[model samples]
Target: MFFCLLSFYGGNGYAENDLQRDNPLEQYRQLFAEQQKEFEKQRRIIEEQGKEIEILKARINSLAAQSPSSQPPATEANNDQTVIAATSPKKKIEIPSKPVGQAPPQASEKPRPPEIPRLSETVGGVLTRKGNLVIEPALEYAYTDNNRVFLDAFTFLPAIAVGLIDLREIKRHSFIGSLAARYGITDRLEFEFRAPYVYRSDSQRSRAVSIGVGEDEIFNASGNDIGDLEFATRYQLNSGSGGWPIFVGNMVATVPTGTSPFEVDFVQSTPGAVFPTELPTGSGYFSFQPSITALYPSDPGVFFGNLSYSYNAETNENVGKVDPGDAVGLSFGMGFALNARSSFSLGYSHKHVFESEINGQTVNGSELDIGQLLIGYSFRFTPKTNINLSLGIGTTEDAQDIKLNLRLPMTFDFLSQAY
Candidate 1:
């Protein structure tokens, strides 16, 4: 027994150790053993698969490789195969759609527009603001039959246009064509200039034998022309007076551009009798007018007022020496807005003339004075267009005349121009 056991152990040991001892071929022997074991395992798997496939093929061939029929068993097998295939790793996931009311973001490729604000208007065209230019034209007819005014009948068809530069320094320029212009002469003061044209015509009949003229002869004068030039200035005094009021000294000048042309004759004078005389026309000599004005602004700014007094010094060669020396005038005014579309103004002006020279004679100046009432209103047709109306009633020592006016103002942006 012992010998038999020893023989068994020795034989195994020799079989294993001998291969290892032959070092020249040891690595190759191990590789061959591993390859042989893999081949045997693959062969066993193939044999099992062959058995199953043969069974399935035998059944299929028995069924004559026929098209799918209304057979219960065949249908079951087909369904099972479909389910297995659907669960495979290669399948894609379905994406859900967005909600019905939701919208996707716009593409990154589109362009956007810049934002710009525009100017608006108010009614009667009384007040309109946009660019720096404004033009106003008015056609008016007036009739009066009193001797206290300049005309029994008159017409003033006038148009004004203006442009302002550096008006209020907010870079907010102010301009009303032919009527109003406020511009900067320096940083602390501004200048305003206006010249309104006036035209007048009238025919009158007078009673004879009153002063020295005959009944058959009457005074008749008919013609029209431009009014005067007005220049004014405003100076900022002491940082706006701290709410008490700011005081500004002003100087204004008016060049009388509209004067009546007339011819006179005594009623009892002979038919061939004549008189020599020189008439003033177009524009009167320059008159230096000075005044002091105060502006009072309110908190939250609803009520504001302006008060002023002025003097006009006569410089005419014909009248300065004989009949008139100078004139004194006073103006008191208050302005209040009724709403965004409306405003109200009340003012009074009184002027006195000094006796001076005429025809080289120290003649007492025949009294001539002026009284005024200012009324203005505006209407808006749209945000960009408007119509405005204003009427002024004037009473002179010699006569009382009535005047009416209207204007339409439209604003347009230069950068957004249309062809």
Candidate 2:
């Protein structure tokens, strides 16, 4: 009985062990099924995201079409073209009912190729950079009233007033002529000289004022050939592509070369419109004038306007120092590049004297106003030589009512030989 009982116990133990061994295998199968389901879910999500990306890309193209920089007027706009192509659903396809006398084809399922990401688009464009070097000759004239600053340097005004000169259409004629030469060292650097011809009392018909104490002052020489000459140099500090703004600077000196109408009668005359009451050339004095300017350009390669301010220093006379008389000027210009060999320009200039003082005294005498118009053109006959022609017409409150200037300049190239 005892042996039979032990055998029964051993058999029961074996059966329990077999059952436990199968538990691990069954758990493994269940876990595998769960993992497969997760993988399929992720794949579907990825496909849906791809379609969304395509939709976003199409939207971007639509927005680009509406922007201001869009293609030219004639080019057809394609706002929704991309979206339609991307989002349209495919039509159903039916299997061909086997063509007559053709072998039936076996259908094998295969994976489809993945969708590609939208990359950047193709564009065509151009950039332009060009420059020009020119040689020019220029002439200028200016006039003013009030003997205090003119005939007599004594009280900032000449006390005696004689007969005024010729007048036309409510304007007086104070005339001066100049001969100038200009050479462009580069697009940025320049060297120029201007020699002005004086209008002597006998050279032209004009009036003379006297200077002295209160009432009847002494007589003086006629105001002719009393103006001075100027020499200047300019440099372009900044210039980008033709479409951008530009900046330039200039330095100038005025030499005492003209006649002196004041010293003749030696009255109260000392200060005038850049003219000295003493002998011609006002003690051979020296002055410095600097100018800074800004420019803006327009299309059609022509319309560009510039404005500038010139700072002038007064003459150094041992008797007394004269305060600086400066000017504010504006220029409006238009030009056309006729061809590779020629160009044309039209412009207007207006200037005003801001303030002045004589011998440390603020005398409210007169303000000098000037207006002028310019028309000019340049031509190049050969690579070695060129000609520039220019003319100027006075508008009002100036030295002359009519004036014309012309220029012809040639260029020599040391760089050409190397190229």
Q: Would you list the C-alpha lDDT of every candidate in the order shown?
A: 0.44, 0.49
Residue 344, model 2: Cα distance from true site in angstroms: 2.8
What are the models' TM-scores? 0.46, 0.46
Local lDDT at 23 for model 1:
79
The sequence of per-residue lDDT tens digits that candidate 1 reaches over residues 19-46 is 6877758788889999999999999988
Runs off by more than 4 Å, candidate 2:
1-187, 193-231, 255-285, 293-300, 316-319, 339-341, 415-419
Weakest ten-residue segment in model 1 by summed lDDT = 114-123
Deviation (Å) of 336 in candidate 2: 2.3
lDDT of 2 at 75: 21
lDDT of 2 by residue, 321-357 (tens): 6665677777666666677777767777777866666
lDDT of 2: 0.49
Instruction: Report the C-alpha displacement of residue 232, candidate 1, in angstroms.
Output: 3.4
